[model samples]
Target chain A: MTALLKIDGLRKRFGGNEAVKNVSFEVNPGECVVLAGDNGAGKSTVIKMISGVYQPTDGKVYMNGALLTGKTPEAVRTAGIETIYQDLALADNLDPGLNLYLGREAVKHVLRFPYLDRKKMREDAAKVMLSLGIVVPDPAAPVREMSGGQRQAIAIARAIHWQAGIVIMDEPTAALGVPEQREVMALIERLKKQGVGIILISHNLPDIFAAADRIIVLARGVVAGERRPAETNDEEIVRMMMGATL
Target chain B: MTDNTVNGSNTNTKPGGTSFVRSLLNAWSWLFLILILGFFEIYAQTQTGSTLLFRIYNLQAISIAASQILLLGLGLTLVIVAGHIDLSIAFSTGFAAVVMALIIRTAGADAGWVTVILAMLAGLGAAALVGAVNGWLVAILNVPSFIGTLGTYGIARGAALIVAGGATVSIRNDHTRAFGNGDILGLPVPLVVAAVLTLICHYLLKHTRFGAHTYALGANRASVERAGVNVKKHLILLFILSAFTAGIGGLIYTSRFSAGAANAGEPILLYAVAAVFIGGASLTGGQGTITGTVIGAFIIAVIQFGLVFCGLPPYWQFVAVGLVIIVAVLVDQSKDRLMGGKS
Candidate 1:
């Protein structure tokens, strides 16, 4: 499979501390790649760089074989890169459809007014939710009134709706209950089936073993190794994450 | 864990009808302000009867005053909703009012109509420029809004004083005076203008993408930035809108008094901010309604009217307004608790 995104020698520094150092990875189309790491292992820093939230101190990011650097978050999003932070970054006050269409709202052309195309947004939101097989009581219901699982699904739906070629989810299921977590993991698999690339950041080993096609372990701001889940067990993945002799 | 369990039990389970009623009680702070205002209105009516209400009533006077504040509050609400405050509005209003007045005076009597129009534009323009400075200082220069707007407050006030030379500039023209005293179908001209603008603001804030973005920005600016809305741009626009209203408020004041005072608008800032808070706008930003603010302004107006109607001592009026402000703030705090304490 062709690599949809390529990062080469990525380095990031915050004052004296180096968060991501000499890290490189490639994500192909339609693959769910998981990055497993212990705390403070620079998982977030790497993700931030990819989503254009932070500038890399030194490195290169290629999206669809074209170089991407110094792009704003809005620019990055326009270029089809969407990120779902662990917080879901979903506005709680806005309803699901509004959240889905936020920033990128559709407007009527009569006077170039900024009215939201509620019917279209609702229809599209319903289609996205239905495609993920996630049921929402009301598309107009605010996310603040939603469960952790449903919010996760809504965030995923938003990224996908934006036509993001690569979806980066930070700890997609860490705080979710078993059923909610399972629902999210299932959605990841669904994304892969639809031929979209996914970069999932997580600490949950079983989920890594079950959902990821390829697992990359990061430790101390470096890429420890990458292995196909079928080729390596969770114990070895854990060893790679902690740099331990296991 | 208990809270989670309680929340969990509510998962897919809305509380019973009783909780719905209970939620209304929990949301009492907003409603209570209205009730208190209503009570005062009733008391005023009872004491003075419809006779005083009819005799002393100048629907146009209230409309003109409220409309000016309405415009100012519209912008102030935007800034305040974004978890910030601007105190320079008084100065912004005075400065714009004087600048326009001077220009109109220079242009001659027929220039009075042109002056009023130009003055409004000048006021809006001045406020917007001041607002832009406020936004840049706060967003780019990283100054706290309180400090930034306060500084601009001093500058704008100084400019107003210098322009008028500490003297009242009478806008003495029948055409301009008509705005202050004229009526349309038993309504003040200023009120009609205010009503029109209020409707426009209501639509923009509630129905437009920019308005939604404003709410998102006010609720959590960082998140809104992350969501890719230009936080600085929005902040600038918010301040501009507020100052613009202040400019109009100054215009209305000048029209009513038929002269501009360098210090004429200082008292209005407190009343405007108070009315906003009393109307259910959170000072923390990200929560409020234009409708609520209009009602709040009415409430204040009613109180003032009520006191004078009852022949209450003028000193008591100050005490009453102060109490209303304190009670309104306390009510706002309690409402936050009921809204899940997020704001």
Candidate 2:
């Protein structure tokens, strides 16, 4: 099967310091590609470039063979690439339904003037959360009162609701509890089943192993090595993360 | 676990119970208004041997006073909720008033209703220009709203002064005077106008996608931008809406008083901003309602009118209104703490 997302020779430079250098990767449909690295590694830079948060010094990013380079983050999202930031990028004052629809809201026309269809949006939010095995008891409550796991779930639900072809998650489970982390891993499995391509940036070894179909270790601004989980172990991946030669 | 169940039980209880309390807390401004009215009514009965709340004349007087501030606050409420301020609205009101009166005076006292309508439009147009300038400064130029609007505040003040020749411009027209003071359906014209505008604003803020984005924009601007919204355009539109409402206040000022001064909206600015805050909006944005702002305006109006009715000095009205504003903000802050800290 053809790859859903392709990053070719991505490089980023901040004045004299090169943040990301010659990183190349591809994610096929229904696959999870984890970018594993130590602190100061180029994982974030690479993802930022792909997500259009940063314009690469030199590189190309393609989704479904369409050039996505240099587009705004909003444009990239419109092209079906959703990035769930580490902060979740949620408006704390808004309820899940509003959060789910955010920039794109459902409206019903009255005398040809459109008003928010809040009831339908709320019902749909509940249905989507329920399908993901998460229950938001009060759909009307603003997301600020929600647990970290619930908030994370809401972010994922937003991506899924939009039918994103590719999802880039940056440390989605970092602030979550053990069970919540497991829930996120399960959600990843569900996304894979839905044939969504995922590029996950994670530091947790166990989580990396559990969720990734292939692991790409980055060190000193370049991919040190790439290996399938079945063909590699934790020590090898860690060594690769620490700049060990393949 | 077969399913990763979220223990929403604990979360559910907080909103279900505290929301009741939170809503009650939100209604503190209304409660304060009622409390003050009661105090004034008792004072009127015991001292003057008459009624304060029961008298139609007294209620009309208070509502008319409130109607002015309400018009100004109606738009500023949206501005503040979007995490911005429009200090220029003060002089925007004055500028519109001056322009409208000038048009009427120039057209001659016996000019037809069409002239009056054209003058009103001209007044609104001038105010919208100020709004657009404020929008361009804040949105496109990346200036802080407070400073940008403050700059325009001075400019608008100067423009009003120049347009009115540094004084009030008086007008004489039966149609304009009737519009200003006439009654409709047993309600004073100004009050009726305010009521209709209030309903429209309430619907816009509560039910429209534009309103939703305003709330989101104030809450977290980055989120709205990332959500694919044209935040710059929205900000521009917001400032224009703010100026538009203040312009209406100016139009009413000219119509009701038969004259428009360069400083017509100067004194009303403080009351308008106070009404917004007392209505439960925060400096941090992302909170507040039009209903709350309406109550807030009435609270100020009652305090001002009640103090006068109680035979206090005019200066005492300032002190009383200031005290009420402080109390309203305190209540708002505490309500935030009670609702699980800042969002």
Candidate 3:
């Protein structure tokens, strides 16, 4: 199948420092492309380029064969790309339902003013929470009152809420414990089954082995190699990540 | 592990040790207000030796003074909640009040209530415009709100002075009399207006998306930006709201005092800030409530009146009130620390 996202010769330079050097990869639909690398291996830079958080110095990014390139995160979102950052990018003071539908809130056709159709939004939020198995005791409780795993689930739900074609998660499981990561892995499996292309940035080896169809290793701002978990082992992948071998 | 491992929540907050304490802490300011009221009541009876706790005229006095603080505090709460402050809000009121008085005075006796209405609208419009200017400066130009509003304060007050030619515009027509002295259901019209305004503000902040966004923006502007909401637009809107309410206070003040001087709004600004701070609004933003602002305003008004009734000098009022603000802030810090520890 044709790749859902294709990044060709992506390069990013900040001042004299080159963060990402002509890294190229293709993420096929219904595939989890695990981006594995050490610190400063340009994993985040590449993700940022794809999500339009940073403008690539030189490259072309194609989503479903359509050229999408730039520093506008909103444009990336409009083009069906959603990013869930490590911070979760959620309003802590706002309720879960409001955070889920923020920026694109559901408003009634009352026409008086942009009054939020809160009832409808709440109902919809409940549906999404249920689908994700996020058993929030009170959806209206502010996110600051939620636990870490629930917040992560909420962020993931928000990213997939509008059926985005590609979901880029930046260290989603970084703050999660073993069981929480397992819970999130199930959600990822569900999304992969739905044919959503996912780029997961994680240091967890077992998770990558379990979920990633193709592991793309970056070393010194270049793609060291791509390997399948069935054929390769963590020791080999760690070497590639450490720039010891490809 | 418990389900509390998901996000920032803890098991302690769910249904454990002391929910009564948590709820009380959640609405701590209300309790604080009642405490202050009770304290003053006891002081009044024992020291002043009179039944002046809820006297009709005493309540009116409290309402009149606290009402203005309540209105100003309402707007400031929004601004502060959104992680911004408008120092020019006081001047926005002064400028609008001066414009209003100028319009009414220029229109003369033949103009009547129509002129009064026109003046009020003009004042509000002018204040809103100034507020928008403050918003643009802070939101669009990326100027720090403190500096932006500082500049506006000087400019607005200067403009008001220049417009009124450093003179007080006195209201001679009976059109404004009703607004100044009229009572609704045994409450002064201004007090009633303040109460209604508080309700509207409560609805806007609690029930509307705009209110949610305001708190979100204050808590984390980056999160709001990533959500694709225009952070600048919300910040600007908040300043505009602050200006609009300040103008309301100014117009009412013009009627109550029967004069609109360029410096009319000067004294109320600091007091309003005190009220918001007293109401449990965090200085860094993202936590303020309408109920807190209302109660905080009353606490401030009561302190101001309580001192005078105790035969304290006028200057002693500030000293006593200042202590209350300090104590309120200390209370806020402790509450924050307690909440933080729980998380």
Which prediction has the highest DockQ against the true structure? 2
After best superposition, candidate 3 residue A72: deviation in angstroms? 5.0
**If the candidates were sorted by their TM-score against the true structure, best first, what order would they fall in?**
2, 3, 1
The residue ranges of model 2 lying beyond 4 angstroms of the native Cα positions read A12-18, A54-59, A65-72, A175-183, A230-234, A244-246, B1-4, B7-20, B341-343
The digit string of per-residue lDDT tens for model 1 on B1-343 reads: 2212112222544546655654674455457655755665566577655543344364444555567667667778767767788888878888777776776666677764666787768766876777788888887888999999999999988888888888878766666788767777777767876787688777777777887787777666655767778878877878877877777777776776677777666877887887778777776677777887787676666566556656777567567778877877776676555444264
Give me the overall lDDT of model 1: 0.76
RMSD of each: 4.3, 2.6, 3.5
Task: Please give, for residues B50-85, the per-residue lDDT of candidate 2 as tens digits.
Answer: 899988999999999898999899989999999999
Categorize the docking of model 1.
Answer: acceptable
User: Which has the better DockQ: candidate 1, or candidate 3?
Assistant: 3
In angstroms, how far off is A136's CA in candidate 2? Answer: 0.7
The per-candidate TM-score of the B chain, in the order shown, comes to 0.86, 0.95, 0.92
Worst 10 residues of 3 chain B by lDDT: B1-10
**How much lDDT does candidate 2 score?**
0.90
lDDT of 1 by residue, A110-170 (tens): 4765676766776788678667666666677566666777778788898788788999988
- Chain A TM per prediction: 0.93, 0.95, 0.93
**Residue A159, model 2, lDDT:** 89
Q: Each predicted complex: what DockQ?
A: 0.30, 0.53, 0.43
Q: What is the C-alpha lDDT of each candidate?
A: 0.76, 0.90, 0.82
Q: What is the C-alpha lDDT profile of model 3 across B1-343, one tens digit per residue?
A: 1433233333425545555666776677677767767887888899878745779888789878999887677888899888888889888889888889889888885668878999999999988988999999999999998899999999999999999898888867677867778888987989998989898888788767788788888888878888777888888888999999898988988888778877777888888988888887878888888888888898888878877777778788788678878987877777665554222
- Give residue B120's error in model 2 in angstroms: 1.4
Best by TM-score: 2
- Pairwise lDDT winner, candidates 1 and 3: 3
